[model samples]
Target: METNTQILSTEDLRSQEYFLNMGPQHPATHGVLRLLLTMDGEIVKNIEPDLGYIHRGIEKMVEYDTYRQIIHVTDRLDYLSSHMNNEAVALAIEKALEVEVSDRIKVIRTMMDELTRIASHLLWWGVMGMDIGALTTFMYAFRDREMINEIMEKTTGARLTMSYNIPGGVMFDLHPDFVKDVKAFIPHMRKVLPEYDRLLTGNIIFQRRMKGVGYLSAEDAISHGASGPVARGSGVRCDIRKKAPYSAYDRVEFDEIIETGGDNLARYQVRMREMYESLNILEQLVDNIPEGPYQMPMRTLIKLPKGEFYQRVETARGEFGVFIVSDGKKNPYRVKFRSPGFSNLNALIQAGRGVKLADLVAIMSTFDFVIPDIDR
Candidate 1:
């Protein structure tokens, strides 16, 4: 025994360990993200991210595109729910240009943003459950996701890439069938979610796998810049939409979901409760999208006025900020996006340490990463 201990010293553990690359094309990765991990059997000894492979210099791409052209680019960043990305960019541009949008447009954007929130959470629930070993819930969650996607496709040219949001307003008015479709979705969504509870939320196997797994304390969660469900799970009540109301959010009322556990289950609960809260916000604003022209018609190009414009919006991931420096020209002198996922990913080194290889997937799913959002 003494001889074996001498042979397998700390130096041996460090030297003989293997480094594994889990993504960039791994099947479980929701997008183009890659996780470089150092492992020892079931435990992850260390993990580091090597980003920029997916970078399209989206920030650079926006400089030449007219403000309208920028909307299309936002679609590809976090394509799971493009409406949220579109809202972040549109709100930023509107604040920068000092443009006044109609009340109807504000209501429309808020409702759409909340819908995006629900859709995004649904997809996360599905993917996270799959990671932790519950396959049926993933299918059930996607069934509900398809409903929201149909709503998106009807209004926008594509379901996954919504160029629906524009600078001063949305690209198209609420469709004639909008109200009826929304009303039908209300009960349909409510009914569909309980099965998720029966299949995954309350299931013993899922609880065993997720509950108390991947714990991240509040201090570390904030210090590392965690956001969205991950931050909220760690007892942070920082929702940008509530703290900094934009569009018609101030006009609507909704609860912020929070959990003290800071575990995989806590993150799951935040997202699950958020879906219900989103439903409440949508119920209030869906029927009241007033009559108005959709996109702000501008034959002229960007022509941003001098000085700078800075704005933040609560995305499905968290607070997304856009900073624009304009020289009173059609092009921005500089454009910088303080993307939410970029900071959230920083916390992974802490949250992921000493976790099981399988639980690593759940930890990452909680981050809800969108690679292009970070790469951009």
Candidate 2:
């Protein structure tokens, strides 16, 4: 028997690059998002995020929705940051109408914002650990997160996408037990937060996986318009709460968490530290909640003056802005949302280059994307 012998060129024997689809249904993606990745074996050479898997035409839909009704639509954009999303649209409408809400409204909105931030961070922390193989962190995180959800449910009558915030102020006043429950949650979170650090932040294996992975420099972060923890991780001072204070954030004193490491670890550290700051914010405001009408009185048919209006708020993930063009009608002529997830995902494409496939998951966990926010 004669066997056929053939020689192959060096180029022909080299490994070939190929494309891989990561999501639209993957657990690590956290939502309905698909990432088109170009890979050379285990290394990710390029990443192009394919979004809109969950698009609901929220922006265009708002054009037909009354100003009051639009608040609920914003809730679905970044469901985790629902309160902040509500506040953004409410604030823009208030700005357009030139209606200054009561001090009570401002303080309550601010407190609720912090609560939402803590809840969002808690879920992210839990999911991040699970993505990296630590399953226990999920239970620990949800345990604390349930406390906040309970508080919100009591006040807003809805847990997740609570459209408690309306254009003028809020749908209703805080629950009678709202302050007490929040105050109780503060200390509990303070005690348990350190446990989180011990469980995941200090884990050597976690650190080795995340510390130097997915590096995004400050310049690149700003160029890509990354905000919230993603930009802060790279030492960018882009906190809208600090730069432009709205709702009672100007009254609170808390350090803006910033980490200069410019890596997945740095991003993780920023959010971890932010949880403490959220607690600090809640501590400062829970007891000092002002007394007055939770919502301001407005015409039954609310119509913004014909012009352009814009408002920005610091949500759990980053800066969330709402821009509205009104035609002096109850509904807006056009509306747009400046969602943080989209910008942070843009930054991810830069940070993810050159990282291994496994490391990409950790980096994405650090980014903490909410798919609807990006797709919207």
By lDDT, the best candidate is 2
- Per-residue CA lDDT of candidate 2, range 82-153, in tens? 999999998998999899999999999998898999999999999999999999999999999999999999
Could you tell me the lDDT of residue 274 within candidate 2? 93
What value does the lDDT take at residue 78 in candidate 2? Answer: 92
Model 1's alpha-carbon lDDT is 0.82
The parts of candidate 1 lying over 4 Å away from their true place are 1-15, 296-299
Estimated TM-score for each candidate: 0.93, 0.96
lDDT, model 1, position 38 = 95
Query: For model 2, which pairs clash?
Result: none
Question: What lDDT score is found at residue 161 in candidate 2?
Answer: 96
